[model samples]
Target chain A: MQTSTHANPRALRDIEMALERTKAEIPVLTPMVTAFGPLLAERFRLREAASGWVGPLPVVDAERFSQGVFVLADSGFQDMSAHLSEAAHGLLPIMANSFPAMAQELNTLIAAMDNGALTMDALAAAGFGEAFTVPGVNAETMDFAVAELVRPFVERQAQDLAKLVRDLPWRQTICPICGGTPNMSVLRRIRNDSEFIQAHGGRRFLRCSCCATEWTHKRISCPSCGCEEPDELVVLSDPSRPFERADACHRCKTFLLCLDTGELADIPDPDVAALTMLPLAHQARRQGFVPLAEHPWGGL
Target chain B: MPKAIFIDTTRCTACRGCQVACKEWKNFPAVPTKQRGTHQNPPDLTHYNFKLVRFSEHLEGDVVQWYFFPDQCRHCLEPPCKEASTVDGAIIRDDATGAVIYTEKSSKEDLETVRSACPYNIPRQDPVTKRLVKCDMCIDRVRANLLPMCVKSCAMGAMNFGNREDMLKLAGERLEAVKKEFPKASLLNQDDVSVIYLVADLPAKYHEFAVAGVSGSMTRKQMLARIFAPVRKIGQQVRG
Candidate 1:
């Protein structure tokens, strides 16, 4: 019996397909993929209807966008809080099931959201403020749940924001839209008639941990700590697992999970791809490096 | 769902790019060979060379026609080779990608029966390791969401790899389109194999083993029983 209820069939099917393929390669990831997959699929379900209810985006100032100022850094973020309470309600129970250790805290957080004692603004502010008093619930647990709740809402808006930023030059390793650090980096396929030569990819794009947004970054530079020295930023990969690797920055003591999409038959769902890259994440973490961004596996 | 490969022979230029790519991907050492009077190097699918571009040129009407058949394991939907195995952990079928894999444990199986059971004559044993080897459908790359080496290396758009339903649909579409020029054009053993070939002419003109004998004694039920017979792998869990 499935613990999570997936309202959207397509979302459930996509994750299932991803899970099957991922399991074929790394049977070791079966447990993690099976556990978190449906939880993420719940987000996919939310995304299906988000476009109708997510409303419109605030117009961007070209100057600020190009100068490293994220879209969410602007004053328009408070308006996104409208859908927060619903997203939190939908995810908390399933997340509690997914993370047994966090279950008690998440259930309490759900009750807080339900009673109107915890407003959307308060949840959103919890991550930013130094002093946050959510009685009995630790700050770290609250922040993680808050980010998860905010994900669907921001992802819906980021779909609209991605097109606007596509032509714009936002080179920061973090997302130009949500300012979230990248959990993964993809080497995009080459342009114009040279695909068969298999030159890997032309540009490096960092995917946002928050809203699933992607922005181009320097292929040589580390997304964390702006480390550009080739020796300091090293790529660790075994020929055995060619698809997934880590770009570890010695200077920052952090790394980014890297995948070359140019070699892949299809661009896999980022979350599913991350599940397969769990071993590489653990490998990097064992070498005394943390992920550039927060992810389920990063903490593990 | 099982995965499949659709090979449209008409689009193939016989560049031998796919053949070389397979060798490189597997890191198989090159074999020394004298010119066999044909472009098909080493003459057949050897233990080291799992893929072969079988060349057959015939004088057709006023033109000298050349047919290139790049051949490998058919990865039969119901592999007779697996059923013929005497050893418990020798031949295995990965249902996920429809790959018929030959493991190191195959050295202990009654090698002759396993080799002869394959209609395509694909299985080859290493003289040293005494283990059977063949194209495992590039299962490693497929698992990693990448195209097979042969399909990835094909520059002429001749080879395609995808889900079984998509390949069947594509094979049907290509057969219909190619039939206009070559009326006898058809898909080879598509129903029984994961690797479906779209031939533009008679199957015999290409190669002797291009298609399986449809009138063979084995019933579909028997094949299904053999296919579903608790297949398992007994070697290193290969990855890309």
Candidate 2:
């Protein structure tokens, strides 16, 4: 059984505000925002398609679980692939004029996905790797495009799976919902009710870049290397934006940007917050540490 | 496989690039000091300074010989300082980089006990933060697939960092070549620690604690404390 909570209107408002703010803030990202705006608008449609679909929950073996498996097989995405492919096609304008061949390839790929002939292996076999290498279209940009398309459906699936596994022990750094590494972390004051008093305490949760799943993680441990030593960990922040900081692991030389939602007057979408924190990623790189996951803006 | 750093002292020219680079990378402010009459400034390692290149001179066979020892944490394979830490997360060895890190929680630990347990006398306490500090092997740079600041800044190729096996191989090759001139050339505590030093003369000539077995200064109580530390930690966790 799944408990349904009403969607917060403020979160949608935050995403809209962020989309507008990002365009004005970073001039270099204008083209990306222009390309992604329409695709993001299609998320509700994809979510509708995902909600109407029915499938059994994935069964993962212990070995696969340890290896960070969330989606068990290619069949899991069969029901929602058409909607995802339609989303992928919506980004065709960004690709068509610059690289006709790549756009043509994407068209074929989308058609194949719609036809149930585009499993991951089939997509690989259909020269997706070669298509992504086209001029002005690299792996990172291609990843962003695909993620924008599939995220809505993947997120819905993840939510349903998350409901079933709420009580299971998952200690790994990877997201238990979608098996994706975290691109950002959230530091929020979680409400607690004990005795007769209500209180709040700071808790850290990692948000996945792929499916938007959030999982509780230890506050002190490095998500990358699992180094619990407090001295080896350092939190760096831009002097101007103290609310956004990078939790760096000196031991592993890796960092993950964290957003203190508690500090925000208006909470921003976590995905949009990731875009705003590109400067933090560059700062972490300047200090000789890699981001746990690559940001869409490529700073990570 | 664990990572390690190999320092060939024979190739070092006492340029102090490694020392300066460490301070630069860590953003450590310079310590104020009077002239100590030697090239080594600040006299000894402090909380701010994690790496220090020590200079020593001795007369051997009526000839003046100078030994330059770039002193830092050895990052022992089984760190005694970690064993001595009573406070949780005061000290921990990084599983990926093999760095023995002194965390901010060290402020809650007995500094003397943690300091005395180190066979190499590496940890230093900050007067302001009340936290113990030392070399963390430049793990940040290492994890980014770059050499440690000290190794990167070394122009003489005396400092090298890589996998344990590759460093041991380099140490062995350097030792073989150095042995042609100095028969006593050897790698110091290579098996016991991550930082392997290739010294052309006796290990003591480089630094007092360059080799592990040579030091018997650790008190019997410290030894016993280290031996039973793991058991005590488990018992405490269970009790809690």
Each model's TM-score for chain A is 0.83, 0.73
lDDT of each: 0.77, 0.70
Candidate 2 residue-wise lDDT, A133-221, digit = tens = 33344455555456555567667776666665555556678877656789888876442212222122246778876667787777789
| Deviation (Å) of A84 in candidate 1 | 3.7
Candidate 2 runs further than 4 Å off: A1-300, B214-222, B228-240
What TM-score is obtained for chain B in each of the predicted models? Answer: 0.89, 0.91
Candidate 1 TM-score over all chains jointly: 0.72
Report residue A232 deviation for candidate 2 (angstroms): 44
Which RMSD values do the candidates have, in order? 7.7, 21.4
DockQ scores for all predicted structures: 0.22, 0.01
Q: Pick the candidate with the highest lDDT.
A: 1
For A176-274, candidate 1 gives per-residue lDDT tens digits of: 877777888877654332224334354677888877877777788877888888789878886876867899999989988888765676556777878
Q: What is the lDDT of residue A230 in candidate 2?
A: 80
